[model samples]
Target: MEIRLRVESAVRDEAEELTSALHDWLREDRDVGRHARIGRLADSGGAPSGAMSADWFGWVQLIAGSGFSTAGLVYAHNAFRASLPRRQQTVSVVIEHNGTRIVLEDASPESAARIAEILSGSGDDEEAPGGSS
Candidate 1:
């Protein structure tokens, strides 16, 4: 499984700071460890993006191995949210698993919690006594 959170920052420096914070958070994760790969997003001009007044400079990409549980993902996301200032950050989450892709835009705590429940198969599974899957 691969998870990537792409957030837009106001400026290039903020983007760099966000990247650093994300790296620190991931490293702190017991599953992600300290072997995650980080990189920046580029534009069609082949130059690093997110440099314009409202361009795409606030972009950071992270690559990590699988072994991360749903609960762990939620924890990581929460930690990431707490690590940054309450700036107007627009975030998108992408998860690739077994060739299938899942994308979530403007992911919030509620959405993360729901995703955790779904991934962990902890959602409402109780049947009406006679119901079936």
Candidate 2:
């Protein structure tokens, strides 16, 4: 299954920076990296800021293969948040699966669990381009 993720911050620069940071951070995860990847270079359309990019901005393509754990994904997110400084910790991370969205801010375990649950489900919602029904 795959989900689209984005980082949002009060400042555009922070959002862009955090988006790249989280992407790199996810790639370092043994479990997640094995099954997930960010936008493909061919899908990329360069712009002033990656966060503000017109194509594939801040999107994560997660493939929950055998041995893939939703908890691991959530844990990685929580850990990433915990790794940030207090001020930047408030930056928001959004995960979207089958129309369900889980926003991570304080990296609460409850939120992590909720995201895990979402990711663990049968994620067959193949959104159309522009997200039209």
Candidate 3:
């Protein structure tokens, strides 16, 4: 599988930083192919400050194929949040595959696990995006 991650941020610098961090994690920890491409979506003036809104700012998309598994994407997101200070940071991750899109918001471990399960097709719940559990 070819997995591509695109991060969009109101802050171009922050988005770029996230892209770099994702690339490093995927490469070093997940053993992703060095050629796997991870990109940063240019800021288009629509990024939510305290919430995960794709309205104006930026978001990240991960596309993976044969050599990559959905689990890798989940792991990367978890790792990313783990490295950050929780009280000041919030991350929203969305995974799209085969027409199925699963979104996970907040920096909680449970959310990450839910995202993984959703992506893996083990989760049968259909909750609104960014909605409470």
Q: Which candidate number would show the highest TM-score if scored against the true structure?
A: 2
lDDT of 3: 0.51
Candidate 2 Cα misplacement greater than 4 A, ranges: 40-56, 122-133
- Residue 76 in model 2: lDDT: 85
lDDT of 3 by residue, 40-115 (tens): 4433445434434444324333444456655555666767767766642454445544444455555465766666
Residue-wise C-alpha lDDT for candidate 2, range 1-133, written one tens digit per residue: 6776667675556766777788888888887887765452212434333345545444555655676777778788888888888888877676777776666656765666657656766333442212121
Give per-model CA RMSD.
9.0, 6.1, 5.4
Runs in model 3 deviating more than 4 A are 2-4, 31-72, 85-88, 121-133
Over the stretch 32-126, how does candidate 1's per-residue lDDT look in tens digits?
55434545544223222446544443334456545556766666766676655565334433333333233434346565755554454453433
Looking at candidate 2, what is the lDDT of residue 103? 64
Query: Each candidate's TM vs. the true structure?
Result: 0.50, 0.73, 0.52
Give one clash count per candidate, in the order shown: 3, 0, 13
